[model samples]
Target chain A: MAVRLYAASVLALDDCLLSVMDIPGVLDALVMDHLSGTVMASGGRGEAERSAPALGETLRVTMDALAGATHRGTVRIDDLIVIADDGYHLLHPVEMPFDGPLVIYVRLDLGRANLALARHQLSSITGRLRG
Target chain B: MAAVHTLLTGLAREHATGSLNVPPAGKAYLREGRIAHLECPRTPSVERLLTAHGRAGGYSRAELEFCVAGAVLDAAYFLLPAELPAARPKFRPGECPRPDTRLEFELAWLVGECARRRAQLAQIWSSAELDDVPVTPAARLPGHRATVSALEWEILLSSDRVATPAELADRLGQPAYSVLLAVRRLAAAGLLVAPLMPRRRGRALDRAVPPALPQSDPNVLAAVKRALEELE
Candidate 1:
């Protein structure tokens, strides 16, 4: 994608979060700040709000680990897909201007989810959010 | 706070509407027994962070509120925890925090998040001792070069050697957790000098906290190393 400075989105993040959750196999979605684990918006059955800090901590550690392995100053991770006891927990990180490294956490149903298509669609949504 | 954790929760339970103040430290604004906003002088505001990082271009109201939500949690991580000897913050009921940014949330949930954050810090370093003790960057970039994230770069650039990670956070107008993460990461990467010599034994000890080795897992490191080589 060509880099163009996007005019900040006027869309309410809550609505954006809700729209993301409507995707097939997407059980829930929460937009959270990675730095402080603050839940900006949640659209799940509702684990996203509570797991904000833990998830943020996870992202911090993961970033450190990735940087170590890559020997890079910073690691730009688009998403992290973790398999859980019930299904899949997909964390999509969106870089926002006002705040974040905002992460969009999505719970996907393994049985019905298309990982590639979902990721592509998520990329699209995040792209629209970028500044 | 008489009961510390319970005080805030209990206040919320009773539908108390006021700001919990920890003077010279931070404040938590409660609206009708629920957490609405938080501000810490030690922890920079979202506006400050956005301005510092040059990411604040034209923030809309929703975007700013989104930032405030993150700011509230970021401050909560430092201010919410049931106090420790290292950074003991005693709160007394005080006036409401001004310029209220209304976003209602349960205090209990925030406390839970604080617990997880405490554990997360331990996961980074066995203890919070290094957090208060000043850290000095290596005279030379260990390997004559270094890779640092935006936060890490700010940390390295502003590391006075006299100011600890907490102090640096305040100085740089960044979140305490983010700065601490950078501090630990720098230590892990061997880009920072260890804070071994304790100047003061005032409660928080400077114990030997081993840095997480990048090469600990041969398999993962090897794959990444190979990928880097391939790119080269």
Candidate 2:
């Protein structure tokens, strides 16, 4: 049955999210629907409820503004990084073949997070999650 | 309804696993008291929204989870605000809807999300009346060049001035709330025909009604009597 198959998928996604949380200094991680700003999966923090829409709105506004500035009809965003005083926020967008795009949001502690290393690992995890 | 919310909260407390059937709206599927899925007639189901457009078959694990989350939220937005019907909500112990999904949400969290979504739509547009009426595009854009989202573009193209946002949502295979939000944004952008002003009730008669007079002063009573006479 489809339900049985879906349960396996859920476990896989949860494991994938666990890997996201394992990245050093990550305060939280969320998989967000780009179109509607829904939080698909969340781990490592309790703020996913509040963060999903705010971060999603930020990404949407940025995407729209950047696309306008470029005079391009459609713009593809790879990663959006925001460095705050207390933390680092990374939004990586993945385009799905059959559904609306998904954005992976991770909040990292400024003192403990390595910007370069976190980005590299996130990219690898995203590649696997996408497939 | 508040009763529905209370029922869900109670169910969560007991760690009840079953479906809560709210007729004329839809049902909520629970796993260990957490909401696993929700379906509402006003919104698209996960299967309908994702697979109905001939894009069926071979969804990645991530994609399935993503769709379920989106669909659950969408259905909750429509279902949670409804008034409880005369028929009491039935709880079928250990009953699972077909194609059960793994995405689960805390009851409190889901309710808060629905409230948040309601507040969002209210902030974007002042009225819910527009949601049910046919979406009518303006004769011209508010300006020569205005920014529009991809969904907005689709809505504009699909708006025949006949289909309401709900109907268009079903036809376009998009979540009903998303379509409603986009329509509201279009209205805010001056891209849709303005809705007619709601008719005001008779105010003169309302003002003419006398206030409670059991303990009123005689002078105030005289004024009230005179005012009542003037209406005649």
Candidate 3:
């Protein structure tokens, strides 16, 4: 029972976080369980454990605000970026099969980061995470 | 009951590998002491959720791992209550669930997380009554408009005005806890029909009224506008 079947279609997401860390000027990367606000995996210099729940709350508030401002029915937030004095915080929500969406949170160096490239990389990473 | 948590903790310390069967609730699978997976009848199992709701074709290891982790935590939340119905727990050594690349959690950390979830839900909604009742969308909005998350929207759409949160969870293949939270949030927002009617037990139900939204100050609105302009 220990030897599970080998299925090529099933790719590993273990490297996704490492890949995010490879992005230029990235300061931190975290995979967060948005529902419970738990940090599933993380890397880099930032305090991911402390920030996951706060970021989750931030995303929730942002979604609510945007929805209210738009007066639209059920708005879905694709990407959220917050600019701080020192750096940038990027959040992307990934839908999961079994539970609420998982959020991928990344912090980037303000002076060294390329915002466009970071966004593109985050999207690509999100695709893999969704898979 | 705390009984399950204590027993699992002891087994983890002993470095036991096998399944701990708590009849009626479910079973816990451990590998080399750490909890690998848990299945509860009251909640959706990872395998069932993955197979039933997973996108067509196979799943990525990340998806598998995420589902496994969520399902385990969810089951633990339901099974680790301080007091549960009376049931004898049996631990069978060297017995594990079918092989797969699964994520394991330390017994202590997992229990703590479950406790956090309980607190989180309690903080959101005071009662568990709505948890099992059919979710009913409010006939009229309390305000001109409201906001809801993707999952909340799903619940609203799937609701037949008859399916309880648990049933909706099963139908949608969502973690029961998540669905429960969404239902409570919807109720808090006045999106769901108020459950103010007294129950058969004669318990006075806390009126599910939406909290009044604070009046927006001009300065705050201006600041928000300025922030939005900057984002654009």
Q: Looking at every candidate separately, what fraction of the true A–B Cα contacts under 8 Å does it contain? A: 0.15, 0.19, 0.47
Writing each residue's lDDT as its tens digit, candidate 2 over B90-180 gives 8999987566555567777678767877887888887765676668888887788777877788888988776667667766667888898
The candidates' DockQ values read: 0.16, 0.14, 0.24
Model 1: which docking level applies?
Answer: incorrect
lDDT of 2 at B13: 94
Which tens-of-lDDT digit does each residue in B147-225 have in candidate 1?
5667777788887677777566655656667687667767767777766675586422232221221122344334333
* TM per candidate, chain B: 0.69, 0.79, 0.78
Worst 10 residues of 1 chain B by lDDT: B207-216
lDDT of 1 by residue, A4-58 (tens): 1111121357656756876789877777767645555676566556676777768
TM-score of 1: 0.68
**Candidate 3 lDDT, B1-232, residue by residue in tens:** 3567887888899999999887655688988888867877666655446555534435555776677677777788876653433765778998866543445677777777777777778888777767766688888999986777778889999987666676676667788788988988888887887444423441222222212322334454443333222321
Question: Taking the tens digit of each residue's C-alpha lDDT, what string does model 2 give over A1-131?
Answer: 00111122345456667778889999878866676665556776567546677888898889878877886757778899999885899999887632367788888999999999999999999888656
Span of 10 residues, lowest total lDDT, candidate 2 chain B:
B204-213
Question: Each prediction's Cα lDDT score?
Answer: 0.62, 0.70, 0.70
Order candidates by DockQ, high to low: 3, 1, 2
Q: Model 3: which docking level applies?
A: acceptable
Query: TM-score winner among the candidates?
Result: 3
List model 3's recovered fraction of native interface contacts, to 2 decimals.
Answer: 0.47
